[model samples]
Target: MTPTPHDLPADLDVFLAAAGWAGATVEPLQGDASFRRYFRVRKPGDKTAMLMDAPPPNEDPGPFLRAARWLDANGMRAPHILADDAARGLVLLEDFGTARMRDYLDQWPDDETAIYTAAVDALVRLHDLPPGPFLNYSMSEYQREARLFTDWYCTARDLYVDAGGFSAAWEAVLGDLLPRQRPGVTVLRDYHAENIMLLGALEKQGLLDFQDALVGHPAYDMVSLLQDARRDVPPELEARMIDHYVRAAGVDKDTFLADYARLGAQRNAKIVGIFVRLWRRDGKPRYLELIPRVWALLERDLAHPALAPVAAWFDANVPTALRESLGGRFEA
Candidate 1:
């Protein structure tokens, strides 16, 4: 069942009272693509905090709490957890204010390069840290994610694709990369513009929506940032940021660039399927609008020689007409 604000726990007030905000004004905020919902808690004296209601059976606050603590402890800017009730699935977190990187960029387009530079710096800092306590982003995981394109996307488009070939192609492409991911850095799977909050300075990028963090290749998060699904990051800027990260992290340029394209293709494919599922199954058609942009990014990723096998699979299955026609066909 999809939870609404009215479906909030009965003891929510009691939980707030226990947390020393007995009568705070709780204003519901817009939700993301999950069962979890957030509320802005404001009290007398202009005090503020964010409340996350991740109800049980469908959602869990454990991973979010664990990741939050780990990021905060490691000198990162994840929101501070003020209070939590794991059994009830409620948490009080520090409010990082209203300056989201996505919105900020929209207002100040001239600051794009500088802001992206800081974001790249943040990734370098994070990759420098030892691996966090998280599940490994193994080859099986990559395969499972990539298969979503065939499973949901092809099915939704009423196109009969070779699902087995899709799997084999991804396996061939990602096989060599998996060996490099041993004891990998923490990959905040959804590390993109909207999830990054700008706290005072561009360098102070506060992280969010990171419950699904995994130990994976350093290039995954970089791809997420540069090849953003929700926004149009200029190709020139993306190239510059890749150069910046390669220099800052002291990694082999050729290997990292290949891995970046590989991971970008994998992630973009997964997102295309997820958006379709969100619309067809979850009744959220707005996500369908993002498919065209994602397809463009995915095509760019497929241009790399590292993704030749997967590229062949796409060429043989998902034709150019269907790719370009998504916007007209899937309108909400």
Candidate 2:
């Protein structure tokens, strides 16, 4: 369902004209895992804006527009929606420039502490907000997501696992952890550096990819930022940022750490399945490269004492040798 060059440009012209920019030229922008594509639109005498081409039958822009409006009203730095066609799945949005936090960090690795501190602070602000319009990160939701690891990776890899026991083990972990989560914090499910733009403002980062925002434990987004699947956040820096958030928010450090580890494992387990599915089903092989790092993070999270049940499941079913094998290009 990829758009041809002629189709995109023609659609872009129609969209731009409707948005009152009759002759704006567009340059392609980098896209994410979804089918949505972005274009940087430039008109002769106006500030550049972004056009999101979320084609119907595959992608939808309603949630994104709703999330953007909510974020704007709630004092977060999500892109402003200039105009949108919900039915066509097109939106003209404010461009936050090209300085993605990931690329910015590469140029100035020394700014890691400063950059991440600001990122964590933004998250603190997000968590502080009163519950608003968003989906709930429920226990059922968590378990359903975690099951993807078994549904895809375990099946594809021919990894034998005790299904009943695995479910019981997961239930034990979820039973302990879910009760402890405070349910109103806004969890931007993909709160990593790549989704954060280095705007160099007091808030420091402009948020993106937040259509999946939900009401969940505050620590969920915290772990997403610190324990990034795509990048290795230094352990010392991770510890320092956790402390910063703890002091800034005045939360119990021990409880928060345990929740962070628990959620991290759950998130990583889901990602392991997603990455494998991207390869085996979608035919996108590049995502397979990140599996090892994700597995390593999962292992780290499993080491936590709170994850005893989940850990035991892994130990009994996954095995040390299989854990070390990592995932990529799995044979049927």
Candidates in order, TM-scores: namely 0.96, 0.94
Q: Which candidate is the best by lDDT?
A: 1
| Tens digit per residue, CA lDDT, model 1, 96-137 | 999999999999999999999999899999999999999999
Give the per-residue lDDT digits (tens) of candidate 2, residues 111-203: 889999999999888878886588888877888889899988898878888877877877887777666555568788999989999775636
Go through the candidates in order and give each one's C-alpha lDDT.
0.91, 0.85
Off-target runs (Cα >4 Å) in candidate 2 are: 1-4, 7-10, 328-332
- At residue 175, what lDDT does model 1 achieve? 97
User: In angstroms, how far off is 202's CA in candidate 1?
Assistant: 1.5
Indicate the worst ten consecutive residues by lDDT in candidate 2. 1-10
Look at candidate 1 and tell me the lDDT of residue 318. Answer: 84
- Roughly what TM-score does model 1 have, to 2 decimal places? 0.96
Which TM-score value belongs to model 2?
Answer: 0.94
Instruction: Estimate the lDDT of model 2.
Output: 0.85
Residues forming the 10-long window of minimal summed lDDT in candidate 1: 323-332
